[model samples]
Target: MEEKKRSGAARYCTVPSCKNNSVRNEGYSFFSFPKQTDRALIRFTRVNYYLLKWERRNMTLPKVFVDIVAKHPHKVAFYFEDDIWSFQRVDEYSNRVANFFLSEGYQRGDCVALLLESRPEYICLWLGLSKIGVKAALINTNLTGDSLVHSIEVAGSKAVVFGSDFKNALKDIQPKIVNLKKYQFNENIWLSPPLFDDAKDLRTCLKEAAMDAVTEHIAKGNLKDHILYIYTSGTTGLPKAAVITNVRYMVMAVGLNKMVAVQNNDCIYDSLPLYHTAGGIVGTGQALLCGGTVAIRKKFSATNFWKDCVKYRCTIAQYIGETCRYLLAADDKNLVKHNVRAMFGNGLKAQIWKPFAEKFGIKEIFEFYGATESNSNLVNIDSTVGAVGFVPFYARFLYPVSLVQCDEVTGEPLRDVNGRYITCGENEPGVLIGKISTLRAVNQFTGYADKVATEKKILRDVFNEGDMYFNTGDILMYDDFGYFYFKDRTGDTFRWKGENVSTSEIEAVISDIAHLSDAVVYGVEVPGAEGKAGMAAIVDQTRSLDLEQFAEGLRKHLPVYAQPIFIRLMDSVELTGTFKLIKRDLVVEGFNIDIVKDDIFFYDVKTKRFVPLTRELYELIMKGEISCPDNFD
Candidate 1:
């Protein structure tokens, strides 16, 4: 392998180990070692080195932002709907935010909940709060009622600052959050006061606040101090607040910047919600840390996705798996030629990988895999179709990530006769884990704010007695070429007909065959069934799903054991802010015709067609009278 000097990327060679001095020497010849190698590890080391530099300089996110502002004061920081915010303007706005909060006697370590959509001000609010050492709990705007209240309560937010658009949501939870100081920001001049008597006019307060730069004395904190509390999607229950320190944020932001080779002039088109890690930190950080301009969107629109990219002259774009599917399914009229050369995000399924790349005219697809709080991160720099990331067999120890055999139902690591966790071999699906090390910030696990919830994600005594690893709660398999592919979520896999059924795999097959953009697969309970039976909820708003064709596709593409026993035709599938499918509701409403208003069908093996799951058929399944297809051969 020849060493290529990429801007913002570290020099790395094909040396088997990092200790090799030959590769470090200048003008050393680089050649392939026949073993698969990953350049991402080199990028990880460079990020680690940068973190060390920040530590030495006593730097934090706010400090770094101020530095960037000083260097590029006139550069456009963000582009919103017909509005461009310069770095100097953002700096001044954040300073006013810090000054106002500081004058209000808000002290260090205090949590302030922020409920706002994706916009330039959203970043400024959190950045300003962090400047004064106040942690901002980035609340999901879509959350309401108990979930909203729980997110705020979990973070112990002393104050809640929200946009006027979300005043109603705040009003609904105001009674529950009695101690919270509410501040409503109306984008337009408020003709009337806030709906609540206690809510203050934040826009007025910010206007009166001073714009003097907040000194280092006020924003004093180590890199380890928590700067933001980003909540989880709350798919199962209430969302858990994940603690993000300055070093952790830098690792996510700068790591991606170097890996994807984002230049200072590069404009990132970010349509994802800012509350999530992908859009909030990684996407926005490109502008703040890398001096690039970010084009923020209120929400993702498949119809307007490419248009915004072309409008902003965006050189880079961001997406998730669902976003890609929607764009692919969108009308060709919405498609347009754009300058987007590189796209980065997770959940780009292999089935649509090539088509998405070709259709969008994107050259590089930086598909990656990792949870919001997990230390085990992987990026597919090679663009191998469907591979989330690659960690060579020889480089596993260096990366400190491994696939260990785990129980599909519990997602717990399985122990051998020697009481040690078993490591999965090549092509064997297992849970991914990253070793928790305190030596480096990149490898350190800065878990959720909930200690018990945090402890649950850490597995102790994995391969050694005292060693610990962060459980990613994801099943993955690696090939001989060191390419790793995502299998399914740990609990998402269920045993059926003495064989394991991967919901992700089944969902992909169903979606591809039905020409549907959205499909969710889960296991449902059946009386006298040894294990949960496969059930699929596919979005078919027009009710145009051809049963005969769908059944024939399933029979040909999927094994009988993996086939969905029940098919649901839903008008729409509910998704999280990041476009992740919400499976809890569908799983809870499992094939119950009375509770579920959507059309349901049963796979009749004899006729090889999905028939209407009426009250008669529902009762037979409940009574364990109907036989499920176990084998077609």
Candidate 2:
């Protein structure tokens, strides 16, 4: 007997009385079962017709989830830690949660604050609230003190429900919440403080309520109604609540599935925090809408990531750039043992893109560029290595996105003699702006709950009078090939020696140096200086910075003014829950050795190496006794 090779094309059945074929396409090889009997043909035809109708219907977020539950009632919907919840089971649980809220006199259109970790219950509550037309303000679990109280109060939340892990944080702000009901989940995990004695136990309430579907309330929901209030990351300032309507979420949920070609058998691994848009909307929503499974974790763990993916049979995964970097740094041999074929999310740097994909065995990288509140959205569907997204000429008319020239110092749009903003040419880095109009529904910017903050993001009279555009506050470059590449944030790009300096560009150079785990570049004000000077905070994994080698690398790769004048060496970098670098404190501290305890070094002109910044040299530089190179002024 001889072994046979698999066929790539359709193979016709050779049975004596059968005329069936098997086809291979889109990574799927399936046999087309014969419909020889009349009953079989009728059943297939009816099912196909219904599926077409369902696809054509205009769906909201809640409707999408409900339809998935109806289609795959017994299919596992969520895998959290050691527990599994089926679609039908989660649906039933959400109904009980909704009933419990209604019993407490909570009416439709009410807003509730959600301060919980990534868990199955957090999702159930969010869905239940949406079913009843109530908005859920997703508070960042890492926030505490004034920031925590401001988030709940600013959203006008009628109630606040938190996980047991956040009990202590909630207790500190309980007295200041004023007239709002407080609730806690998983009370068995930890006891609430005595200060929160009045807080209701949501777990007990759900267990006591009937598992009945709130069909009437769900049916009353409008597609345009507010469903979620996701907050900004607050790296620049205080976090603001961004409104997420049902229609917006629907677009994300369905659009991601279509762009990524998600299937019913797929299981998505989502270790990103649930409070963020990537995890909540793209990760969780895509899975639910496709009738797939979601494997969630308390938080991202580089050591346990591949193990969980293999255990849950995950075919897709979500990531941020920092998470991918951590995975690359980890020494786990099980990295290539999983079944993940695709990875989706934003912030995957150009330098790390190809290596991350190849090492992880991911064939597709669905990188996207968008803000939580902004209307602008772009996705790279073809796995364009370094590009965030592609804006084809045909689709540009519909998106209304443009790149405009910006002033480096003011971080504002540059205007010509007519006071009209100038649009950047191809390959020019500029601020990304999306035209705002009621006619272009997809380009609509609902903005933040804070009306003042909402107005601040709008840039009027750009190309023409009476025209308005939403400022993305991000600098990007558009190439001739119709691909958009991220440059840096507006404030992140600073002026030095009459030229604009991109922190991201410099960070990329620093990241290429061996023994350096991470680097954060920013601008710092110098005494008697015209513009801010470049500075960097670096994490040296080797605990010893070879100044000569590091300086040589920077001098060769970076321009004179782009090179950092000062460097702070640290063991680790502080990051937000979503893996965004926390730069506020570092920027404030600057290179002041008195304020910053970290070891600081200054680039010496004669030695061509970085040396310790003693107090004598620091004062001389401040007093004009020492001059920096390229100080044209």
Candidate 3:
């Protein structure tokens, strides 16, 4: 039979009998957040409808990949650096890994930790492990010492597969986890003898192992079985292992593929870390499940993002957190023209969403909202400016998501006299919750590996006596049109000056006024203050922030209580794998000049200006002598 080919830009319904087209392709107006028309309702109703037909019947991701490989063995699956990985090659490589592990007496229900940079081998190792019902714990590469050991130990990993570049990190915890079978592989070239005495060379073992496919019985798993454990960002505290079942993975991947209208020939430019759900699952799903090519980058470079897209002829791209902001800050001369049509992910603020799309010539920006463990998921089908996602009135019954009033200080869901959780009215900020149901895989929440942590997220007797809902830990407000907008994280909103202040709102305003890519906003406890005081941290290496202009902007844009009292000028702000600001350390340091090496400035309320936080001034503020704006209750 002659080989079949499809254009990268080709568009049509994937289901044979279905005639409905994507909202983007059907000429829907891009001006609004909500669509009430029958056409709009029909278009969104088909989301994941095609995938649902076979999703329950499909076994695992590896099985799906094998099927795709059989159909298109020679198709390019991954473009990593200068190398191109074909589907057949990836399958064979994974088979070798599976065979090696099986030969070493590894069996079903075993956990293996993966500590490697973003690369094709990283995916192959995890996929291969999944072939034998072994779960892969995707560890963040940036972690070291105690954090690294905790992540591995929490997952109960019997073995660890690490890149040669991270041998030192493994070595640091090698004594602590002496029982762990350490397997190492070098990205460049394999060492003759392993550099670490305790570590084994994984490449040599794979080369020695057979490349034949494992038998179906040995490689089978229930769709609900856990295949991967993806850790949370640890922005709030220690990272929690969020369980990623095969069914959950399938739902996430298929949902993105269907909603984005991904084509088989489309190339996705993925610059996110492979450990993250956005990069590992959603981004890779475009090519792995939907069929296409994924261009991988070891690290995200704002300067090279566009250049790489152009280099790989990528038709689609991914972004999360401050990625778009960083790109906007990059020198325009280096941002070469590209053929990217659609960009998807979360955290593109409304302030820069339109400008970033317009400047880069992107046609559609599909912003989505979902967490690693939560079942509540939403996607913006229309390019409504600033809308994270929309749950139209017509689709609310299908989605089963609602916003409930929450205590401003404690972040606990507020209940009425009847002991029932109060649902927020339109335009009211509240904690978003998703009703948990086992009928469909999309509405299920697997939660964390720790049962205690898992239970903390479940709200029993939420609306009824026995019903349960997953607390998203996010504050969201939906407009009258049912267009949901992100407000802040539950714990991130601080009480100040007898009012609740949202850190996200302050950060967005500060980032805009500073003309910077990102800013970190948090509340710090003052010695004499009634509540936590607002603090903003901006990355300004030179300490040349225009204090007068910034103060003026703050006065105009923010109220007295919302305005940050302390500003920390840092050389750079630490970010997580997903580009989320790490505020724990900053919050710990607070505004203490002795502890913080960076320059600190205090907002002079009397003068309506900002001045350096000198020792005398700090003492005066600590002693409650410094005059300030209205005090908190």
Candidate 4:
């Protein structure tokens, strides 16, 4: 829903849902080590939310086309839970699907909405669309109401393949779907126990269309053809659809295969949602390019993860930091059973890097740094502690990036007239900005209807000329050896539970509770953290706060992903001259809960209420002696 826009300093909370998003300076704003003055006015406006710079992708995804048929046509390429398909078989089936669509008059660049979740058929649909240059609009499963409706309209999808199970959810707007040709998903297979029977049955319905005619159209497909649309989690209020060209897919595939050492026989185990880039780009595209094997799980199951790894004999598994923490907490005996030798993905924290590696016997760890809209990327195959990895050139071709001094009130970065910002010397931390060369800018997107979305991501006039560079929106500290260490993400997004936690989503539920006028939520370091812990800084309505009621209320309404673990109750809220909650101070204070001389309250998950953070409880959490659900089962 729409909310009021606060004036001047008060406007901090006006960017959609801010009360639940921002960090309060009342006594617990997140701490910052800002450099000296002489910068532009930097009052806390919501972190520049939209600026994303996706580096240029390879113009074409590495293709097998006629070559793979000559190479390893007989080897199995796809194995469903119940059925297996060889490369030659998949080649024919996808061709059939591609042919079916073309016979139905489908053309290149047409938008086809995919409502199916993670399954073998979903991948087939994606690959088949790629063969014909059609775009797949991967809709977020969590979207609802107007947001869900708006996503389809904005994408202008020509047709929707809605999962049979989710079709009823869209019944309200089904009749109103304009420019829509058909709504087909699990027409029969998405029913009953799917024993690879759905895909098998789908072959029959497609038989009416002449497969011979489909051939002429498939020949026109190229690496630069398919447009893959990855929708952002609306945790940022409104999600934007990123345009992924076939070239982008190819680049990631090649880069990941080389960096992660994925060979034709290696298995890639992915439990992450295919809707995400980590799943689609790195998992699916990369595997397809290498002609390797990929085993897909229905979804991420903590208890079932390692078992799946061993079950599939997976060599390379993709992971999120939060997931690692959970895996680390699992019974130590289970770690040795898996054949997983290497792990890849981002958000693996520095604190737990070595311990996790040693515990799980993971030999190679490739931590990469890239957003859907990235200008550069670092793939650390060496498993460097917290380092995103190394960029080839352009970025490293120039100088080091690190944190610097800036105006506390207004966060204007200090750059010189030459358009080059001051480097954070050797072994210093600075804002990591990838130099956007003509080549690296290829993967950049022309967003869905938001002009500001495009402009906000560009930082113009660098190098004394009026050239534009997309900002990474992250802080990186450099060391004496030219290695980059991730400092933090410089926006409202904080990591928790292996996912990006939108500060605004957290604040929305928090501010709704009575007596809580404002809430600032962020991820903080929990001892032995695989990722950040959710912490909220809130304003109490009464001297005798009803924290028990507050905890109960949040527990009832919010999902596990959005809840705050530590609650720091402030006497009053503090804002800047511009009314922005200063986080630097509060981040430094953290949630000492009981140690600090404040009326702070900690939520006891087991006790089911708020209790003062006594020193004993704090030590218990730090020592890893406390039995809690902070980690996965």
Model 1 lDDT tens row, 1-633: 223323101222211121232222222123443222436556656766777898788788888888889998999999998989999999999999999999999989999999977888889998998888999999977666666788899998999988888887777766798878988877666375444668888888999999998886445767888999987532243568999999889888988888767787789999888988899999999987778899999888887888999889999999876578668877899988899988999877666777777787787788888767979888876566777887666666667899999875456689999888899987899999999999877788999988988998899988889999998888899765566888866555665543445677677677778989798888887764545689998888888988898988776656566779899888887675523236766777898888998889998988888899989998998886886775311
lDDT by residue (1-633, candidate 4, tens digit) is 012112222322322222343322321112431110001011101111111111221223324433564488887665545566666766666666677777667788788877767776677676677677778888765554444566676677877776656654466565467446654556354354342211223435455644442444455655445468876532354456776765566556656675555677788888877877887778876446567877787677677788787877788898887777777777756654888888898888766777777777777677887776564555654454666764322234332223443333333456765556565664455555555554432334333334666566666665447655556666676533234667666666666665566677667767776456577777777676655677788776466557778887676545455568788877766764544346655666777654446666666778877777778888888887763345345
Candidates sorted on lDDT, descending: 1, 3, 2, 4
How well is each residue in 101-167 modelled by candidate 2, as lDDT tens digits? 9888888889999988898888889899888888999987766665678789889899999877788
The list of candidate 3 runs beyond 4 A from truth reads 1-44, 190-194, 233-236, 492-633
Candidate 4: residue 106 lDDT (0-100): 78
lDDT of 1 at 62: 83
What CA RMSD would you report for each candidate? 12.3, 14.6, 13.2, 12.8
User: What lDDT score is found at residue 109 in candidate 3?
Assistant: 90
Highest-lDDT candidate? 1
The TM-scores of all predictions, comma-separated, are 0.75, 0.71, 0.75, 0.75
lDDT against the true structure, per candidate, is: 0.79, 0.75, 0.77, 0.60
lDDT of 3 at 381: 60
Superposed model 2: Cα runs more than 4 Å off? 1-58, 187-195, 234-236, 334-336, 492-633
The CA lDDT at 531 in model 2 is: 52
Better structure of 1 and 3 per lDDT:
1
The Cα RMSD in angstroms, rounded to one decimal, for candidate 1 relative to the true structure is: 12.3
